[model samples]
Every structure is written in C-alpha cells, then in structure tokens.
Target: MEPLTEAQRRTLEDLYQRIDERVSPIAGTHAWWPCRKGCDHCCRHLAAPLTITRLEWTYLWEGFQALPPEAQAEIRARVAELEGTQRPYTCPFLDRESGGCRVYAHRPMACRTYGFYVSRGTGNWCHLILGLVEKHGDGDIIWGNQDAMEDTLERLSGSTLSLFEWFATEGC
Candidate 1:
C-alpha cells in the first residue's frame, strides 16, 4: 500500500466528520444507549474479521505506527494467531484489560458506526443495544444511514479488504 495522498487524507477526515455528525446526537439522546467506553461486547465477540477500505487501512496504519514498539509487537502476534479463529474472535486492537480499543481514534467505519447505524432497516448493534431497545422501545433512536456511508466510503476509498487480509499482505 502506498502513502495516502493529501486528497485521500482530506476525504477521510471529511468522512469521519460526517459519521460523527450522524452519531453524536444519537449517542447523546438514546435512553439506554450502551455504547460507552469500556463496553467491549462488540470487540470481544466479532461475528467476522472486519472488512475495511484501503483508505481506512491507510488511516488505521497511522494509528498502528503511533503505538509503542512493545504494543505493536503484541498486536502483530495477535494477528498472527488470528488464523482459523472461530466466530467470536476478539479484535487484535482491543486492550483486553482495559476493554477499550488500542486504535479507537483510528478504528474503521464499521467500528465507528456499529451501534448507531442501520442498513436495510435493521440495526447493526450488538445484543446489549438490542436488549435496551427492546426494553425502552426504539422511538427515540436516530439511526445513521449505513448504506450511504458505505457508498461514500467506496467512492473515497476505491477498494475493500478484510483487516486480516490487509495485515497479511501489507505488513503492518
């Protein structure tokens, strides 16, 4: 992978801004929004290896580069061991002890939009959110447009690949 061009960086920043714009209100107003920091349900029980755009990988690489060497090495080992892992595989970037993302600021669109976004009229959040919504009802929820965000990401990023694939081929 090549270094992101200035335009690409700018585009990523804009996309992130749009995501925040859509998510912030929901995160603030939802009666039982369960997506606070230290809530690692989604990270711990990933349904699949996260797929991300090249543009996202480029940005995520910047965050990976910022970590200390020891942390980087630990993440590399985790990725190496991810092969053949089962459905509930934990993300390598998650800090198990702290239950927070090691690359929270640089997480991919999927992570950023997980609890707030909807596609095909279905919420993409974890069971905790579902439970809360079930109990509180979804009348106040403002779901972000996942499909539109995906389209924009495709337009900006061009190509997509799984996080595992990115690390395996690109050498993080």
Candidate 2:
C-alpha cells in the first residue's frame, strides 16, 4: 500500500466525515443498538477476503503504519493466519481484549458501515445482524446501501483487490 498524499488524506477525511455524519446520528439515536464495545459480532464474521479499492487499501495502510510496532506485528500475524482460512474470517484489526477496532478512525468504508444492511435478495437483510434486529422486527429498519456504496468505492478507486491478499502481499 502506498503512503497517502496530503490531498488524498484531505479527501479521505472529508468523505469519512460525511459518512460519520450520517451513521453517527442514526447509530446514536438507537439506544438499544446492539453494536456495543464488546459486541464485535460483525467484525468477527465479516473479515476481509472481500474486495476493497486501492485507495481504501492505502488509507487503511496509513492507519496500520500508525500503530506501535508490537501492535503492528500482532495484527500482521493475524493477517498471515487468515491467508489460508476459508470464508467468514476475523478482522486483523480487532483488539482481542478490548473487542474493538484497533484502527477505528481509518477503517475502510465496509468496516465503517457493517450493520443490518439491506440485501438484494427478497425481503432480507444481512444474516449476521439478524439476531440484533429481531427484536425491532422491521419497525423503521436501519437501512444500509452497502451494495451501492461498494459500487461507488470501486468507481472512485478504480483498482480492486481482496483485502487479505492485499495485506499478505503488500506488507504493513
């Protein structure tokens, strides 16, 4: 992953701020939103074998570079382990003790928006969030345009790679 240029960082910050503006208000409004500090359900279930654009990857690398060497090594180890795993892996950035993102500020858009995302399938949301949403039962369901967002990211970045593979090959 390349170092982020100043202009790129500015653009990234603005984009992230826009996302936070939307997600934060809605997330905070739901007092019962099950996405608490220790509840890293989505983080565990939705790890990176998924495609993320090069720009997003570079931004994430910037965050990874900021961590202390020990933390970076630990995260690298986690990423290495995931290289041979099957689908549905855990995020390397997860802090095991804290059960939180190590690079929350610089997490990719996919990481930023993991929730009861509306699926393209008939009357379905993401399965991982099903239990958390069961109690609400579709009363003003917190919808997420994950598909559209992915499309937008792909368009903007213009280069795509599997995140785990990217990590393994690119080196923190």
Q: Return the top candidate by TM-score.
A: 1
lDDT per residue, candidate 1, 102-137, as tens digits? 998899999988878888866565778788888888
Query: What TM-score does candidate 1 reach?
Result: 0.94
Tens digits of per-residue lDDT for model 2, 1-172:
5677888778777767766776676567777676667888667776446567778888888788899999999998887788878768888898988898998877888766666344466333346356656866657655766677667667767677787768767864
Instruction: Itemize residue pairs with steric clashes in candidate 2.
Output: none
**Candidate 1 global lDDT:** 0.87
Name model 1 segments beyond 4 Å from true.
Answer: none
Supply the global lDDT for candidate 2: 0.73
Residue 101 accuracy (lDDT) in model 2: 92
Q: Which candidate is the best by lDDT?
A: 1
